[model samples]
Target chain A: MAQYELYRRSSLGMALTDTLDELITESHIDPQIAMKVLAQFDLTIAEALHNRVKAKAAIKGHLHVYRFCDDVWTFIVDRPTFKLEGSETVHADRIKVVACTARAPPGGKPE
Target chain B: MSNQLVPSVYTYVIDEVCEKVAPTFAEMGVGQNVLAELRQTWKRKIASMRVADFDFKESFDDGYGVYDGAGGQYGTEYYGGDHNDSSFAAAANLAALASGVGGDGTAPDSYHIPQNDGAGDEAQAETSKVVETAQPSQREIDELVQRLWQERHRAEGEAAEEQGRGSLAKQRIRQLDGVDDDDDEEDEDDNEDGIGSDLDDEDSEDETADVSHIILCQYEKVNRVKNKWKCTLKDGIITVNGRDYVFNKAQGDFEW
Candidate 1:
């Protein structure tokens, strides 16, 4: 449980890291040794996208709003604990990385 | 002639086919075969609807389950009826089918329930009198989207682990393990009915929960014309009709 705390984090960075952790937990799962049968599945592909609109910023020059859905492999998550989903974008200047998180559904976290 | 027996007979034939074929495919472990058989069963029922002068789309509603309205438009929510019997039925059926209890078009000796005499007529009358409404609450939709999103992560993480990416494998392992923890937390949060109280309880724990989570996006095919929405989730994103929707489980946040 302690090892998986990174995945259950609220931060985007930690969420991404947690995705990897989840993968490890699912692999080579033995039912007799554990509580239940393991649900063996894989995550092969993922698409991360960001679009941003900023209202107020310190240095306002021609801020480039680029559709960044294209770049493949060039972009990487700094943190693995965080898990990313859905369609979203971020607005910033001089930013090294932009990570997107989904809007939590109208209800709360799932039961 | 005001004959209701024709449609009922056709439904019985179709049900017979489904009752025979669905289990066989399950035992053979061929999902496509099962789907094809189910689709045929649906087609047969559709014919029954046509013969009875009822709208096929209206009565059958979606392929997954029957909706609660006319024109199959409103009240188009999930299957919210009796789960106890179906759960047992589905499980028993699956086990029997998986064990090769019967062959194609052969009714399992053990699987026979009484037929409904007036059920079809009542269903027909009910369909004519009601208009469809959105039965699922906003919360139900959200939960559906969330569950789908979680599935996406499980899928992608497994793929990464297979490729021997040590880090990716480790991450997936952690998430899989976390499911148990979350389940415990969820149980604590769940109401007696077990709807989605775990989500409601997350607000207080949001800060402590890690925020930097990885999102998995999954792509699945959905056919609106067929009243089918197939989806797979990965990296927190759900793809249906080639469009993307996100599922963020983090607390006090909704955009991903």
Candidate 2:
């Protein structure tokens, strides 16, 4: 009985703008739309992150997903050296992260 | 090509240009030492920009010999004939079309026939050159930096969260093992009650819930694989290998 919905893929910035546009255009926006937008944002951000990590040959960070309004949201950041298995090398001084989420409609599934 | 040093810092080879040919133009007004320094600086900047990743070779070599230093992988670039009078019409058209440019020469407009006039061709050529020249533009650098920063941040958060989850799981496991403290027992009851109320609200739409549906979305980020969940429910708990996972009342969606 499980159903699935797919959203278009785009950059994090574009996804944010799209979500805002949808909200403004449709007075009664559905959670499914928000979920799709946020999922897309997360995927784009993750791909960019993965590419960077591969290019630099360094362990970049981790992504966190949490439940929000019947959907899931992801936040990404760099892993600290101390927190890693091998703390003897590659110490990170500071890091940054991006937060995004996917929401489902009142009676729909979140993706 | 070996003898005509273009004296350019860029490690790329222009179509027929070689690095050996220090342009007579570069020598006339500029002192030889100054020109050499400029070339060195250009090389350093290119290095900083990491153009090597794009396969830009150091010099160019044609049968007659190199002129501008064009040995690297040829990339789309704008070549200008007259600086001020140059038009990227052709290049722009090509680029526009390539970039999915539409009708009104603007995004969101209907597609139109691309300009095919001389001016249009020149313009398009210019666009091609400029696009190559601007490869590692400031905007690109900023984007790279921003992405890297985000990965770093996400990794940190995940580590912390996983640690927290592990601890919580351990605490719960211990309590379930029947060696729980009074406090632990109380928490179990509280959780059950709370979750039960949530379930009651959820069951109102049980007719639409189904356990067969599950969507797992995973992606690589910051050199790590991350998993995201998507799920909808009907009236039953999704038992995966004898374990139940919480899901909402909607259908699941995901992509590989």
Candidate 3:
């Protein structure tokens, strides 16, 4: 699967970046190495999610804004509740969804 | 339960990335210890986020998670186990600490007496505790001030450009400046909501301001009719409430 740069915005991604930043700042690793690590992270996280996670979530929200641009869909929802399996729920004041097209465009990068 | 999967998924990602990058590190002549250190540091940072009980190592459990739990427990004991009393004390201590460090030295003598109690080891422990709590608040205040300064600079930059535009555009810029100021005020109010609430407040602010609560996944189909929308998203990493969840499939229903 082609890696999307989108997952880099998650907390897991941010934590990785912060750690890499500290390493770079302290001369523990080169910037180039850090970039390679991040690229690897992008691929690994996508595959791990697809292969390892079996959970499903149901989201209900008031859609405030929706945009389809460049084969990606962006949804801004206000006061969203994510109901996962087993009655677990997560509530947020607002959530933004960025979904890449599942079906790869012909001759384009597959998501 | 989905949120519960975060730690393991993250751990898997971290381990896999480390493994994949090992050859590169060796090729670059970087020491393997640094790779191991990177893993440790990454895990430590994630643990500090307190999204869940990581429980990966005894050291992390003792170092960060237990420190947080102990802080709360200490407050409860000090305030006779009353939640409201403990929170009020925590707020007062935060205010006193903030003013003591950020402003003039007039933050009431009562708050300073403990620091000057001269109880030897007891005094040292109390001072360290104060420092431990003070550091995060100081960092947050610094960040908020930096953001406000940046916003001011941006508004000035826009004003300079507005002089070349029509008066209508200038009015629009002014309105935008008003909106920015309102948002700043709201941020300040969030900061003042109390020390205990600060973490959650900052998280939500990050979510809204930086679009942190986002899902990056592949959509199989997204259909809409009237004001209703439905979508089937798969292989997504969803971040909400400062925790990450991975879902193989997600069904979204929303009304505009």
Best by DockQ: 3
Q: How accurate locally is residue A104 in candidate 2, as Cα lDDT from 0 to 100?
A: 34
Ranking by lDDT: 3, 2, 1
CAPRI-style quality class for the chain A–B interface of candidate 3: medium
lDDT comparison, 2 vs 3, better candidate: 3
- List model 2 lDDT by residue over A1-111, tens digit each: 112222122121232444334343443234443454344333333332223221111222332222233233222222322111223223332222111223333333443
Clash pairs, candidate 3, are none
lDDT of 2 by residue, B158-218 (tens): 5555666854977756665776577577867776656445544444333222221222222
lDDT of 3 by residue, B73-134 (tens): 32223334354333444544555454444343434323323533335535454676544443
Here the TM-score of candidate 3's chain B is: 0.45
Report lDDT (Cα) of residue B168, candidate 2.
91
Q: List, residue by residue over B120-144, the lDDT tens digit for candidate 1.
A: 4334434332223113344543553
CA error at residue B46 for candidate 2, angstroms: 12
lDDT of 3 at B89: 47
- Candidate 3's C-alpha runs over 4 A off are A105-111, B57-212
Ten contiguous residues minimizing lDDT sum, candidate 2 chain A: A50-59
